[model samples]
Target: MFSADTEQWARDTFHHSELGDRRRSKRLVQLASSLANHLGQSLVQSLKSPADIEAAYRFTRNQAIDPQAIAEAGFAATVENTKHYECLLALEDTTSLEFSHSTVRGDMGHTTSNNYSRGMFAHSVLLFAPHEQHVVGLIEQERWTRNIKDYGKSQNHAKRPYLEKESYKCERASRAMETRLGEGMSKIISVCDREADLIEYLAYKTSNQQRFVVRSMQSRCILESEDKLYQYSASLTDAGMRTVQVRQKGGRKARRAVCEVRYAPITVKVPSNKKGEPVELYYVGCQEREQEKGLNWHILTSEPVRSKEEAERILDYYEKRWLIEEFHKAWKSGGTQVENLRMQSKENLERMVVILAFIAVRLHQLRYLGLNKEEAEKQSCEMILSPQSWKILWSKQEKRKPPKKAPSLYWAYINLGKLAGWYDSKRNGRVGWERLWEGWFILQTILEGYLLAKSLDL
Candidate 1:
C-alpha cells in the first residue's frame, strides 16, 4: 500500500535507517523487501536464494546492528505520512510474542508464570486516519523481554517505581510520539483501552496537553465532591442513545447494542499515595439498554464532551481502539506469525521481529482497504497490488485475457479470497485475514512466474 512495488516501498521505508553502516541499511531494505513480498512465511520460504538467506542471518546476527534503529526508520516513515493528515487516532496496545522452541527458549523470558513459556512483550502505537477510516502506520513500538523472577510480582506493583511498571510502556510510547511528531502532536488523539487508565499515565497526558480517550478501569475520587468518579457520572442526565456494533469475543456473538450515553465534566483528585495535582477531565459513560449483559463502557477523556454529538464522537474514538487489537493479532498469530521464528539469539530475534512488524502493518493495511465495500469498489486495485500482480491475478481469476484497466479493489479482494479456496455464499460472511494472505501468497507465486516468463520472452 505504501508504493507500487514491495522492493521500492521497502527502500522508501528503510533507506534512511541509521544501521551504523550504509551496506547494513541497504541489506535491511533488501531483507525487508523479500520478507514483505512473501509475508507470513518462514525465513527459508520467504528468501528466494540461499545467499540472500545467509546474508539475512548475518545482518541480524551482527552485534553492531541495533534493532531499535531498524524500527526507528519505519517510525520515521510513518511520522512523515502522518503530516499529510489534519487529524489521526493514535491507537496504542500491548501484545506478547511467545517462542516455545528449545533452541530459543534460553534467550527469552517467561511470558507467564510457567517458566517454559518464553517470550517478549511488544507495545505498539498504530496511527489511523479517522476521517479516511484507514490505518496510517505504526508510529512507535517497544519490545522487551520480562525478567523471569518478576513473573509473580503483580501484588507489589504499587510499591514499584512508576517507570519500572509495565504500564509505563503506554506513557513511554506517548513521549516517543510527541518527540517524533513535534508540531503534529496536536493533530493526534490518542485512543487507548482500559489498561491505560493509570493515574500517572492520565496525568502525564493532561500535563503535556496530549488529547486522549482512555477507557476507565478504576473510579478515582472526585475533587470537592463526596461521590467517586463513576458515581458522579451515573448521576448525570442521559444525553442520548447510540447504537453500536459490538464485536464478537470468544463465545459472544456479534450484535448491535443500543447504549444510553451520559457524560459530564469532572475533576479527578490524585490518590493520597500519589504526588500529582488534581486533573480536570470529561467522563463519557455508555450503558447498554437492550441486553442484560451487553456492552458497558466507562470512557475518560481529555477531549471536551459537552454535547451529545461530542460524547458520541468520544465513544467513536474509543471504539477505534479495537483496530490496535486486530493489528496485534495480525502481527502475532493471524498473518506474520512472528512467534514461528527460530533465531538462536535474542538480538537476532529482535532484529527479525522489528522487520516483520512492518510487514504485518502492510498486511493489515491491505485487509483494511477492503473493509469498506463502497470505498473499495471505487478505489483501484493498484492501490495495493502492482500492475503486473493485478493483471496476472485478473487473468487467472477471470479465465481470460487481462483487462486493459485495473479492476476495483473489492473485486480483487473477493477474488483473492476465492484464490485461497474461500466459497462466496450466504453462510460465509466477509473474508478474513487468513484467506486474504493465502490469496496473496498464491498471487505472488503467479506474479513471480509471469515476470520470469517475460524476462525469457517465452
Candidate 2:
C-alpha cells in the first residue's frame, strides 16, 4: 500500500531532483534502499554483497522508488509519518559495532580523536512506541568528526545540518517532541540509560511536556555530601553497598530474607578527568539486588521516586525496552545481508537500520489494532475480548477464580501456541501474526462446535 504513494513521498524530501531527475538522482533513496534491504534480511552476516545493486534496486522497484537515494528520503518520510500519527517517544542508545575488535583501522568510527577504529562504526537508534517496543525514530551519524574533531556549524537555512553530537539525544528528541506536539500526542515520556543525561530534557518539557525517565550518569552533574564534588560511577559498583534482609514470596516460610543495599550520592567529572570543565552529573547508585548464585547492581532515577505506585509502574514498563532487542533479532533473522552491502558510507547503514526498524514495528502493531471497531465493540484491552474470545477465555478465567492467583502472560502464550498448532514445531517459541490468526480462527471454530453440541444436548 505504501508503494502506491512512493513518488509523491519522494518528491517532498528532496533537492536537486526534478521529476525528471534520472529516476535515481535522489541521494536519500539510494541510502534508504540499503536500509530496506537490511530490514528485509535475516541477519547482518547474510546480506548479499553490496555490489549486488541489482537486488537492492529490484526491492526498491517493488516498493516503487529509485534505489540510489532511498535510505535518506525514507528516513525523513518515516519520521514525518510517525509524527503524523503521534508515535514518537524516547529511543534507546546505539549498540556499538566493532567497538571490541581492537582494529588497526581506527579512523572510521573512533571517539573523535579518541583514535577508535572501531572499524566501520555504523548503526544508530531504533525508535519505538510509548513502551519503546517498535521503532518510531532513527538518528544516524554522517558528520562524525573523529580525526578533525569538528561537528561543523549550524545555520538557519534549508540545507543546515546538525553537529555530530547534536544527533545523539537532545536535539533529535526535541525534534521528535515538537513533531508530536503538532500531531497532538499527549503524555510523551523519554526513557534512557546513563548516557542521555546531557541532553537538555527538562528544558523541552511542553506545558504537556514529555517527561524524562532517564537513568543518571555519575559525573560532574552528580552531587555528593554537603553538595560536595565526588566522581560517581555509572552503576552501583562504586556506590558503597550494604546488605540487609527483605521479603521473599513463595518460600517454605513466608517472608524469606533477602539482601538490601544503599549508596550515597556523589559527583563524577566527565571526559573522565577534565578539570574545571564538567560534562556530566551523577546521582550515584544506592542499592544492590543480591541473588544466591550471583549478584546484580541497580540504580534509581536521579530524581526522587515520589510515589511507590509510580515507582512500580516505572519498573514495570521499563522492562518493555527488551522488546526492541527481540524486534531487532526478528528483523535480522534472515541475515544482515543488507549490512554486508557496505553502503557508500556508514551513514547509509545507520539510516537503513532506523527506517527498517520503524517499518518492522508498524507491521507488528497493525495486527492487534482494529481497523474500524468502535470503542464499545472491543474488550477493555486487558479484560476486553471478542465474543468468541470471551467464550473460550471465560472458562479458564473461571477455573482459576477466587483464591487462585491470576495467571501471568505465560498462559496467553501457551494457549496461543496450542491453538495455533505450533506445539509440534522445533522453533515453537514466537508465534508470528500468521500463527496468531490461525489460533484465533481455531479458537473461534472450537467455541462454535461446543456451542452447537450443547444446543443438541439440550
Candidate 3:
C-alpha cells in the first residue's frame, strides 16, 4: 500500500498541471503514486481494483491532459528547486520510447536499427547538482513521432533549412530550456553528446548567452583555413592527465581510463546553406593513453577553458550526461517499466510517459541516496525508508538483537541488497540498482503482511 506522505508529495509535485478539470489532475497524482509504488507491475496490478483501472483509462483517454503542460509543471518545480543551488548542469540528450506493439491512433518513429517501430523520440534536459553529483530531475522534454516520409530526404545533397532537418531536435530541446530559464544565468551549463555538435546550435546558445559543452561530431573547416579538427587538436600539447571512470558495456567490467586533456580555440566555418556567420568555440579533447581501442572524447564548449582545472570541470559536466541515460534505463526496464503501459492512443501514452519519467528519476534518487555510508550515517533512515521498513529489515537481517534506534539507512540498504542475493564479502561490493529495487519490492510485499497482522491484533 502507498503511504499517505508519498501520495501527498505526488499530488504536490503535480499540482501545477492543469489537466482540464482540477479533479483530473488530482486523479493523476493518485494514479502516478500507484504506478511508482508497484514498479514493473502492469497498470491493472498497480491500480489494484477494477474501478480504479477503469478510472485510470478514463483519465488516460482524456484529451485535456496535455503532455507538454504536465511536463512544464514538473519543470517549474525543478527550476524552483534549482534556485537554491549556485550551479546546476543541464544534461541534454534524446532517447526513443518504444511501443512497437501498440496500435496507437498515430504515426510512430523508427527505432535505432531503422526498424519499423511505434514510439516517440524524447529530447530532454536532465538537471544535476554538480557538487553533490545527484540527479535533480528533468527540467524540459520535447516529444515527437517521426514522419517516415521525410527519412531519406536529408541524405540528398540539398540546402534545406535547419528547421527542416531532423537534427533540429537538439535545438528544440535547448530552446525549450532557454525559454523556461532565460539566458546569462551563469549557474547552468547545457551538456550534450556528439549529436549536438552542430554549429547552428552552438551559435544559438552563444547568441543567447547560454553556457554549453557539446562533444564534437563534425570535422568541418576551422580557423579561416582547411585545418581539420583532429589534426589541429593533436598539434596542441597536453594540458594535463586525469583518470576517469568509464561504464562497462557488452560484458566488460567497469574500469578507469587514464587520458591526457588538451584545449584550443577554433572558429568553425558556417555551412553555406545556413545564415549564421562563423562560430568561434573552444575545443577540449581527451585521448586515452592505454590499450588498442579505448575512450577518446573531443568536446566543444561555449565556456572558455584557460587552465586544466577549468577543462576538467567542463568534462565533469559531460560525465553527468550519463545520469540522464541511466534515468532512461530506470524509466524503461529497470524500475517503472513505462513500455508496459497499454494505452491505445498517442495522447494517452504521452501523458503516462511524463508521469513515469519523473517517477523513474525519483526511483534512481532513492537508489543513490543510501549508497554513501558516511552521509547516510549522519542522517535518519526515516528520511527515505519508513519506520516499519527499517525496523523489519533490522530484525530480519541482524538476526540476534535489534538496535534501539533504527539502523542507518545505508545499513538498511546493505541488508536489502543481501536480501536480493548479494553476499557479505568485501569483493561483493555495494548494492546495485537492479538488486536494490528487487529487495525494495519484496520488502513492500512483506510490509503489507506485517500491517495486516497488526490490524488483526487491534
- Compute each candidate's TM-score over C-alphas: 0.97, 0.46, 0.91
**Per-residue lDDT for 21-72 in model 1, tens only?**
8999999999998888777888789898999989988998998999999999
Candidate lDDT scores, in order, read: 0.87, 0.39, 0.77
Q: In model 1, how large is the Cα lDDT of residue 9?
A: 84
- Distance from true position, residue 238, model 1, in Å? 1.0
Q: lDDT, candidate 3, residue 422? A: 72
Better of 1 and 3 by TM-score: 1
| Candidate 1 residue 389 C-alpha distance from true site, Å | 1.5
Runs of candidate 2 exceeding 4 Å displacement:
1-88, 97-127, 130-173, 176-186, 199-210, 219-286, 291-305, 327-335, 342-428, 431-458
lDDT per residue (tens digit) for residues 1-458 in model 2: 12212233334433333223454445444434333332343323213466545544433334334222434443454445465444444445433333232223333544432443343332334445543333444422222324334322333322333244443545464455455344333434455655555423433332234454555443334334333222233333431333323222236332222333334433333333322333222132333344454323233333334443444444433444554453344334422322333343344344444345444443233222321233213323222233445446546444543222333233443454456665636452445544443454455456557888988995
Q: Which order, best to worst by lDDT?
A: 1, 3, 2
Q: Please name the candidate that would achieve the greatest TM-score relative to the true structure.
A: 1
Stretches of candidate 3 off by over 4 Å are: 1-5, 100-107, 157-159, 183-185, 224-226, 251-253, 371-374, 423-430
The most accurate candidate by lDDT is 1
CA lDDT, candidate 1, residue 406: 92
Q: TM-score of model 3 relative to the true fold?
A: 0.91
| Candidate 3 local lDDT, 1-458, one digit each (tens) | 11224576576667787767888878888887787677677778877689999998888888877888788778877776777677888887888888855576255666555656668788878888888756677788888887766665546625677777667878787777767776425788888988888777888888877888899887777864566888778788899898888886569888899999998888888877677788888888988967768888889898888888889988888887778887787888777878777777788888888888888877777666665577767766676678877777777777766667766767866777887787757563467666776777777777778998999995
Each candidate: how many clashes?
A: 0, 45, 0
- The Cα error of candidate 2 at residue 249, in Å, is 27
